[model samples]
Every structure is written in structure tokens, then in C-alpha cells.
Target: MLLEATDIHKTFQEGRETVHVLNGVTLSLARGEIVSLEGPSGSGKTTLLSIVGCILTPTSGRVVIEQHGVNAQHQGELARVRRQYIGFVFQQFNLFPALTALENIEYALNIKGVKGAAAQREAQRVLVAVGLAERLHFLPRDLSGGQKQRVAVARALAGNSPLILADEPTANLDSVTGGQVLEMFRALAKQENRGLLIVTHDPKVRAVADRVLKIEDGRLI
Candidate 1:
């Protein structure tokens, strides 16, 4: 399994009461599979992603990535492990406005300690994989919504992480573009042997997932 999350629970402290978010959510994702979590807004979809990505500490339960359990107490170690094992795609297409498509991908690799020609090579390769070789020089403002999301996917895959966690990846695109992205994800999972866990409300995206999981009232339904 690329990712295993067992009996996960998350609680937030409100002004005078406690808000229970995730309640004993357990999930496992294996390589070459696409799993989608479908939930309504404020249904703890993003919260669950945060916990599994090791960005937030679960109030209870354990998260293991490639068999290594995340230690919530050690913030630095958690950060390192998350960087080593997981890549993220977000709904907002969080690209740097100042950087071109290639530059944005290269920037991610650069921070991961890949530099110079190696970084450029990998960035180019990833963009090509996402069918964006011709858009390498286009800045975020110059690209269409679908193209921007493709860049985001390229960025996520640039790290060569075994697991990709995407939150509403196709939320911003039209149905046709969104379908294209979903198909691309299917190909990537098979070709690269990567595991994908996506959180989305779109039925079209859910239709493409190998497994669809629904959550409501902080519990998997």
C-alpha cells in the first residue's frame, strides 16, 4: 500500500464546544489506483486530506505512508516525510504568477534539492507527460483554467512521489477539460505506478475513480 490511514479522527476546538470532524475514518490506497472521496462542503474532506498528508495532527489514529508511521509530535520529521512521499494538487491551481509553467514545476524540484540542468530536465519531462510541452513558457495568467490545472498536476508529479493527494482537482474546469484531466490521472496511475487519493464533489470526477468513498457527518458512509 502506498498510503494507509487507520481509524483517523480530528476534532477542532470552538469557542466553548468541540467540533468533531473526522470520526474513525480508515482508508488504504494502493499503487496504480485512483480513489475519490466525495463529500459535501464543510464535511471534513479537506481536513482528512490534511491529516493524511501529515500537515495536521489527527486527534486520534495513525497515518502510515509506505509503511512509515507519521509522528505528529515531530513537526520537522513529519514535514520531511510528507515531502518525501506525497505530492498535492489543489482546487485553486496555486501557481506562482511570476513564473512560467516550466519554471513553476522547476521551482518545486529546486526546493526538493534538485538544481540546475537536472531540475530543468525533470520539469520539462513532467510537463510533457501532462501534454503541456508547448505551454512551457506561458505564465499562469496566459493559460486557460484547464491548462493551469494541468500545470498543477505536473508540479505534483514532478517530485516523483509515490502518492498524490488532490483536493477538488477538477473543481475549476469545464466538463470536457475536467474529463481530460481525469483521464490523464488514470494514465499516470497505471504508467507511473502512482497512487492517487482525490477529494471532490463532482460526479464526473467520481465516475472516473476506481473506488468512490462517501463521507457524511464526519464518518465514511
Candidate 2:
């Protein structure tokens, strides 16, 4: 297994009231496989993905990335492990307006302190893999919805992270375009041999996953 979360629990307090979110959730993923988390609105699917991505720490649970053997690491160390091994994509394009598509990918490498001409070269290679090489110079405002999504995917791939977490990645695209994006994700999972977990309500995506998990009322059913 690449990821393992055992008996995860989380809660949030808003003012004097405590809101329950995830309750004893456990999940795992293996290499070179695609998993889809399916849920309706108000389900805890997003919350679960957030925890898995290390975007939100669990109130109580164990999260272990088996490859890095990080179960015993501290909070800061766990975060660094996540940064070096995980890539995240969201429903929104989340592209920087001022930066071109190629530049945006390079910025991700820059965050990891990878610099110079080599970073740009690798960024271009990733963009080409995602079928966005011709539009490398375009800004987010000038690209179509599918093209923008490809750019977002390129950014995620630039790091060469072993795990990719996508939250409603194709929610904004038309059915035809969404299918293309789904195909791209499948290719990434197979060609890159990475673990790809997507949290979405889209039926089209569910069809593409190796396994589909249903979530309801904060529980995986």
C-alpha cells in the first residue's frame, strides 16, 4: 500500500457548537491504481481527501505512507514528506492569472528549490505529456475549460509526485471534454505507475476508476 489511514477521526468547533465531520474513517491505496470516492453533497468525502493529502491533520488516527516509512515522523516532517510525494488537483482550475501555463508548472518546481534551465525543460516535458505543449505560452484567461484543466494537470505532474489527489477534477467540463480529462488521468495512472485517488460525484469518472467507494453521513458504506 502507498497510503494507509487507520481509524481516522476529525471534528470542528464553530463558536460553541462542535460539528462532526469524519468518524472513524479508514482508507488505503496501492501503486498504479485509480480509486474514486463517491458521495453526495454534505458527505465527508472531501474531508477524507483533505486528510489523506496532509492538508488537514486528523484529530486522532494514524496516517502512514508506506514507501517513505513516515508513521513515526512529527507534524512538520510529515508535511515535508507529503510535499515531496503528493500532488493535488482541485475542481477549480487554480492557475495563476499572471503566469503562463509553462511558468505555472515551473513555479511548482521552484517551490521544491529545483531551479535553472533544467526545471523549465522538465516542466515543458510534463506539459507535453498532458497534451498542452502547443499552448505553453497561454495564460489561464485565454485558455478554454479543457485546456485549462490540462494545464492544472501539468502543474500537478511537474513534481513527479507518486500520489495524486484530485477533488472533483472534471466538475466544470462538458461531458465530452470531461471524458477526455478522465482518459488523461487513466493514462497518467498507467504510464506513470502512480496512485491516483479522485473525490468526485461525477458518474463518468466513477466508470474509469479501478475501485469506487461510496460515502454517506460521514461513513464509508
Best by TM-score: 1
Worst 10 residues of 1 by lDDT: 77-86
TM values, all candidates: 0.97, 0.94
Tens digits of lDDT, candidate 1, 1-221? 88999999999999999999999999999988899999988888899999999899999999999989889889998879777888889899999999999999999888777889999999999999999999999999999999999999999898788989999998899999999998997788678989999999899877778999998878899
lDDT digits (tens) for residues 7-125 of candidate 2: 88888898999878888888899988899999999888998998888877788887777555554337777668766888888799898999999998898888766788988998899
Candidate 2 lDDT at 186 equals 87
Mark the regions of model 2 whose C-alpha exceeds 4 Å error after superposition: 69-75
Clashing pairs in 1: none
- Model 2 scores a TM of 0.94
Give residue 22's error in model 1 in angstroms: 0.8
- Estimate the TM-score for candidate 1: 0.97
